[model samples]
Target chain A: MENKTEYKPFEVDQHLTAHGNYWAGKAGSRFFTSLRDKKKLLGSPCKACNKVFWPPRSVCTFCFGELKDMVEIGPLGTVETFTLVTYSEPIQPRTAPFIYAVIRLDGADTGMAHFLDEVEIGKVHIGMRVQPVFAKDRKGNILDIQYFKPL
Target chain B: MATKDKEWISIPMTVDVPYRFAAGGYMTKCLTELRDNGKIFAVECPKCKRVQLPPRVVCAECHVKNEKWVELPHEGTLMNFTIMYLPLTDPTTGKPHEPPFVYGSVRLDGATSVLDHMVEVEPDMDKVWVGMRCRLVLRPKEERIGDLSDIRYIEPLPGQKKPQTKSR
Candidate 1:
């Protein structure tokens, strides 16, 4: 194929940088705090249907009721889907080809999303069992569980 | 009357902005290395046989992993190019890319695909065209960051003959 240099139009000059802070809301705080205790947590039940929500939503999806309190969940689950990631410069750790996945944790009705590590990409599957690997020192944070690995 | 006073009122100001990055995978490492070495790299998919420029971790078409790495030749033929007269914000650095500038996709000599970059060209509105040859200008290592800026811009390769366009 021949190389063609045709003048096309584009907006070539605008600029910006990392310009804000992330503030966790109430449900987010509680969700992470419970993870520090080594307890898998999900948002409150619907008084009507007894369903659990994760990422601890403010309201129930099934019954449409307000959610309150939190419930502890098990650590194991099956992999639903995943993709590989590569973190680079200015990206601390500089890790490339890192895998992240959506896991359907055991005992919890809904799945949680997090980084997947310590396994072969080909070995992983939709039904592969996996568990969260918490950091040695826990402070009740989502990062407390560094990532999930095949069990 | 008010113009004289307004001239003295001019002062420098800074503005803050928010941005999100979606970068991930081996492409990140490849770009980092390119900035570090003053070179560019690409990957070839064994399955579909399409050499992907700006190497990706997996083949989008083949659904297979790409593990081999090959260093690319710095020179290339300018594929599709453009000269933008309007200003736009730089996504990575959050600054404005200079106006009256050119950008294009260049097919590196060794790689199978073309990459987009700042193409060197005359600012005159009259004399730009297709099938131009360009060369890469790289930044020094110490000053380099693992970003596209590592290679300053693509300029006309030395001693290359200009193409004659057929008049329609």
Candidate 2:
């Protein structure tokens, strides 16, 4: 029955525009504001399991305990893993051939994804020491820290 | 418990997501024919014989395969219309189509479905009306990109005056 049926192919291209507003709730506001005002990185340490979250959460994933203790994590961190992006898109913060890395900051148990700058892509490797390069003009946002560079 | 005033802060952000969709077998056939040959094709249901535009594989109502193909004429009658005052987004380009434009659903000659598109007439009651005779105005062949936007806009057939309005 499938062999008897004939098929013809066609293509339709559609583009859509979407607009939305997002609020970085209670815990996230604290994490981002500290980065903006003091150029400090903060993490929420779970009292039960003792795991530190880089992008701090209000509740622990394992114990569901309220996480109130905020600790300063890293001015410097080690690159856990990274990739070099050669393609461009409308939403990308930087131009093509930029290095994006997962960095495990000093005194923190978790890693966060951010851009790595001031070094060749061929030179970036796991365990490379990197430090945050804070932007001159600060906003309570992730981009407040311009990028991490080899230290 | 001691009560303490807590300061809460909020931040603003924007996210843009892009996507691509594949027009499957039936629609591909209909759109290509419209693009290359300047002919509109529809699929007719095997059970109910209702011809659907942007041809589908199965009849939505009858649940039977739509195998027969029908070519519809370029001219159609304006079934309903609205003068948009809001800047509606054109999804394909993530841009807003300029406001205060005439948009209408047209039921083409010899087709059961209505094609909704921009109606290129003044946004006035005396100028545009229901049952207006309109024809598809396609983009030039060189500019045709095998998409719905290829049909530039629908315009009132030349020399046709608005129908006489009747009192309710």
Candidate 3:
């Protein structure tokens, strides 16, 4: 059907660059600092509930306790859940068809989400044993653990 | 075990948010006309007879359908102006327009509305003022794209000088 116009539609391309400064809180400060300096994975533990959350959070979800002390978590873990992203996005860390998985690290009570690699997309599944590959130039963020690979 | 010294860090990050816009029927006709023929078009309201540029489908004042098209002259009068001191990013191109530049609203000859555009003149007050005559400077025909960027900037018509201060 003719929309009946003298000219074709025009598409305009544009982008916005957003600048932000974020502070790592009391627990997160120590958590990220551990990753950048010592190449260590730290977990925040809630003593009342005995739950250690990896990708350390400031507060415990269930018991609502203040998680002050941090414990070193795993460089190795198991994939609890995962999905392969077939489409590309501007904000993704890698190219398309990469895997993002929820990993339950050894000695930690909860699952943390991160990128998974070094294995065939078809072969990856739940309970797959994996180990982290740390980035050489760590920026004191979760990206410090670049990705996880099959053990 | 007692924790060691506090090691807190604040991180600075830059993120890019991409965007795309579609120029609908009214603007599509106006922009394409500029790119292809170097002609400008404005929609005239049947009720109020207001010729608005960047042609709109509906009249802003009369609430009537804008059906009549009027051609606008590239020449116009500067209604108002400002000398910018901060480097504001041009959202269309994602680049800064560079500080201490001049831009203003120009009401083209025969058009009722004014279009805000970059004025290609020295930023000093002595070099520019309100009510100055200006003409649009567009990119070459071969380089013209069907967007507002097709018009490079506004150039003030020569021979006019800023008036001396009033004695009042």
Candidate 4:
């Protein structure tokens, strides 16, 4: 409180930056390496539950089965759902007036979330086939595959 | 693709989160004045009459609302200090101040609470001590935007030498 009851509002711009080294862990390391080096998508399968998760997890979400092995998924995928982001947020990977969609890559049972571009917002629809667009500067992160474009 | 599995990959991430906050009544008045006019103001408790820097709405000890604003002098005493050997990032600017530097709490004249800031001086032990007189240096008016950063640093006043002491 600056006063007993009243005061004018003033804004101060600041940043809370945290620099850290993240261990992508065994499962994430395998997934990211292939994605970054080979320009490929990988998914881990849960045999017990008959599910394959894209952005492969170390273990199955449905069952407690260990998913140590990764199989190549697709550069091609179908849009499961989509939305348009018109407002700005600090955490947003891209600026406002962009599209984000849930896409299920070929050979993967689960949907992976990523940005969608190279298509109009009005043209986007569920089950629309799309392809991954790789970045020129490939850092070993999810953003290495910049966005998904319409096939 | 066949590759080395001996060394598992780890991703290095630096999360830069932008933060914003609204400076309320007393703080807005205080910071705006300091930002625009280069004046430092604090609030005094009505009941106990203790003046506080970074002026607050209530005096916690007195249990009364603060109404009076007091202007403090740029000069004060170096009450406490430490020489940091680590290059630590300043949260306000998201940049690291080079290692081997000095910073301290300075109690400005007419203020009850001490203000903490970087002390501009050599990091050598022989140069700094408690009770050392210091003066607040502020950024030029054109550069100030009404935050605590307006006060650039605290520099030790001239001609003050550490008192001689006997060693055990």
Residue range B45-133, candidate 4, lDDT tens digits: 98999999989999999888998888899999999999999998878876898988898999998789999989999998899999999
Interface RMSD (Å) of candidate 4: 3.5
State each candidate's chain A TM-score: 0.73, 0.88, 0.85, 0.87
lDDT of each: 0.69, 0.85, 0.88, 0.88
Q: What are the clashing pairs of model 2?
A: A10-B28, A14-B92, A15-B91, A15-B92, A16-B91
TM-score of candidate 2 chain A against the true chain A: 0.88
**Residue A22 lDDT in candidate 2:** 65
Cα error of candidate 1 at position B71, Å: 1.0
* Candidate 3: CAPRI quality band: medium
Instruction: Give TM per candidate.
Output: 0.46, 0.72, 0.79, 0.74
C-alpha RMSD (angstroms) for model 3:
4.3
Task: Give the per-residue lDDT digits (tens) of candidate 3, residues B1-168.
Answer: 435677667788899887888988878888888999998899888998988988988987888888888889999999999999999888767689998899899999999999898999999999899989999999998999887778999999999999888868
DockQ of 1: 0.05
Candidate 2 residue B41 Cα shift, in angstroms, is 1.6
- DockQ value of candidate 2: 0.31
lDDT string, candidate 1, A12-69, tens digits? 2334644443444556656666666546655554667766665667677877777766
Per-residue lDDT tens digits of candidate 4, residues A34-149? 88788978899888888889878988998888888888888899999999999998778778999999999998998978999989999999999999999988878999989999
* Residues A39-112 of candidate 3: C-alpha lDDT, one tens digit per residue: 98889888888788877888899988877788998878999999999999877768898899999999899998
Cα lDDT tens digits, model 2, A14-119, are 4444456566766887888788889999988996796998888899878999998799999899999999999998778887989999999898888999999999
